[model samples]
Target chain A: MSNKVIKYILILALAIIAAIVIFEFVSNNPDKRPSNPFEFNVDNYKAVDETLISYKETRQIAIKDGIPGAIAFSHGQLYLLVDDYLQVILPGGMEVFKRKLSEKPNCIAVDRDGFIFIGFENRIRTYDKVGIEINLSEVASDKSHFTALAVSDDLIYVADAGEKQIRVYDKKLQQKHVFNGESGVSDVHGFILPSAHFDLAVNSDNELWAVNPGLHAIQNYSETGRLRGFWSKSSFENDGFSGCCNPYYIAFLSNGSFVTSEKGLVRIKIHKESGELSSVVAAPEKFSNGTKAPALAVDESDNIIALDFDRKMIRFFEPK
Target chain B: MSKLQSRRQFISGCARYSLGLTIAGVIGFSLTNASSQQWLWQIDPFKCTNCGRCATHCVLNPSAVKCVHAYALCGYCDLCGGYLKPGHIARNTAAENQLCPTAAIERKLIEEPYYEYHINEELCIGCAKCVEGCSSFGNGSLHLQIRQNICVNCNECAIARVCPSDAIKRIPADEPYLIKGGFEHGQTL
Candidate 1:
């Protein structure tokens, strides 16, 4: 072979040897595996301090589309949520009734007489237990995004996100009074994005509890609209509201204790009957990876119900 | 002329050497980046709907979805909200009350006052029935979160965009989780 041919072959041989060495080095060492991507490792998962109760799968509730926002039960019937409508099912998971509407239904309530009241965009839709639409009334206020519904005797309380107050109406849909805002006396207008609105049941002394998550406090009130006491004041540390939306949802346990779900910091708190604060749910180690629970409901068994904003799943919790 | 031809040959050799170096550099960079940042599959716990899609919807045969326990948040009740039916047992632990469809969450008496409940990740099929029970009735001690190891980490997480509360978020790998303190006897270090 010529000298030039030998030189070219030598260069090619050198290049091939270099490539083999580099490939061998890379194939020998590998990267470490990711930690708990499925969130299955119990040793590292957070929220390890609270008491855990018995939990089982729900066979009756099936979420079809979008995430479920609010869940309620009326006359032993279970209600799961979709974006545009509320799906009503039997306790055995039978699809019995569905209330179809044009807009999204965020909050739902049923009175003692089996009257179903739902809060939708800018209006409240009332129905009999049979899923028949009764009345659809538009609130006179603008930017009135209704999110919560509560029925106390003949009075219905609607939490209007726009007006920033619990609007009071008679069973027949008459506007009787407004609890907060420019015209109300109790100054509950101080709340920030009060998403789930409700009033507690009347005690033996005819007392009730109402919470404004925006203000981070629960107010005690009488049927006559008297401000009796404030249960708890929210502090911005060690289990308090930290996000722009403030407290998203609240529910009362059977023992008179209550659970509050907050955004930003994203923790579920348990307040004792004496008003001592204890954290039942804190954000997981993978913080800010999940959305807050925007709405809450307490079943007759004192189980706390929350709709996870991120997962679009209906979550339940028992008091520790 | 022979000297001139030799000089031209040297010039061509130099140009080829430079071109090979540039190509090698580009290939090296691409390979390093490709293998280094491959841990992509993740579940946005916030956006997951607990629809049992994790059990059925994953591209993998075993479904990348697995059950996760937020142990710090658990209440450790005898009749755990996530483990039992609301009225199935009269405030006690039993087979009739557990919510796990595959009986994956196991409970053992750790001591006189405390019970240890754990999920068998291998047996878990990602049906979030237990998570729903815990979040609604109990302290939300048991929740469904994606394990990154098994996740394929698609360009778009199938469950994240559909989330109602928008709870799912991307976190860094080193300090990956958002730890919360929950129930008694639960430890987070």
Candidate 2:
């Protein structure tokens, strides 16, 4: 072959290789590339509407440089579990009493007689009205990560998200029965806890209402661990629960309505006992973006109190 | 013809023929292997919704997903949108001032208005909090990508099962990573 022809062929090959390299480099550069249509943006956040249950923010109480964990109401007063301390406050936002605790408290419950039951990482500690700690080793287990606590006149229910079961105890704190939402309960498949967000609340009839977060359902179980009934609906609209695990926290009002709080969307809504959508207490725009799940509680006057974790404040909402 | 001339011609022909055959064989093998090889698990940053599930849904105690920074795209601003909160007043390393819950992103002062940020992969929980802040408020440089070395590559990834946005996907093994701000083609890490 002629030298001129050979030189032309080599130059052609080099040009092709350079074009391929440049094409690959430009195509792979995300900034120079076309924007993906599926990219999610936090700026597009839209708060859902407030329907049947309209709420007006009546008050806000500061937690004194602490993040609120769990909240409960007893004896016409609010009990807030903050960082290593339980602060007791009145309905008008006055500090009644405050006491420091040894272990970090995840959840709290108060009995009819004002006895406080605090749930730690793996055990339950009881405190009398006078702030004396009561030791209950029989009910304590390292295998449990107690995320929610509920006290009835006869039985004490502990919602263990770690073990995916509810442990029942008597007034003496003796382990009575274990309900995992499995076994003989045909309708109750099991609790689907994707994270440590499982919560439960006791209604006026002392029935256990556990938040089946994964399914976006509230399950009703008898004291004997029998699956009674449930109310659930899944939707992205304002009326229904949204996200993987929603309504992470639950509380019951005096009229048997449910006050629920969700995490990802960060909203509080009220639902009828039969799972009917009532009204929105606080919309997503009410709280800061990326707010964690707020602790929820309902007092006798039907006022909804939210322990805002992100803002570190205890806010009260009343029916308008 | 002389014997030496004939022998030289014969050897030249054989060498040219073998070179052609070798080139053809390499191209054919690469084409066939590229089509048949299985892909590994990867996260497409474009599809990720940052729902905070990547931190908890992984089979591992701490997820294999880690934040990767595209230095080429980064502005390297002293007031980094990813490192500081939206209304942060001071450019200090205080726990309350930083955006990351775990403080995984380390910031170094490069100059008066430029700072270099590095990700501590061990401390990252795959939450993508900083990525969200950076993308929404500043240059979209920081993003989440699954670390194949750390990922177990389960048949059905636990994170994929619960990912709300379905961002996790199986990509060709030849092109294992989907790095931002660069085109890798079918190159392997």
Best by TM-score: 2
For each candidate, what's the DockQ?
0.02, 0.02
**How far out, in Å, is residue B161 in model 2?**
34
lDDT of 1 at B68: 80
Model 2 chain A: worst 10 consecutive residues (lDDT sum): A36-45
TM-score of candidate 1 against the unseen true structure: 0.50
* lDDT tens readout by residue for model 1, A69-157: 67666567666657777677765557887777667787777777888888786678888877788887756487677777777677776
lDDT at A138, model 2: 64
Which tens-of-lDDT digit does each residue in A1-320 have in candidate 2?
99999999999999999999998687545456454332233333344544444898988987766767889888988888878898888877888888999879998999999898888887778898755687553635666889999988888899998788888888778788887774233554477654455798899988898887656678988887777988887654566665445777899988899988876567888888888888889887888875376888887778889889888888999989
Superposed Cα deviation of residue A109, candidate 1 (Å): 1.1
Name the lDDT of candidate 2: 0.78
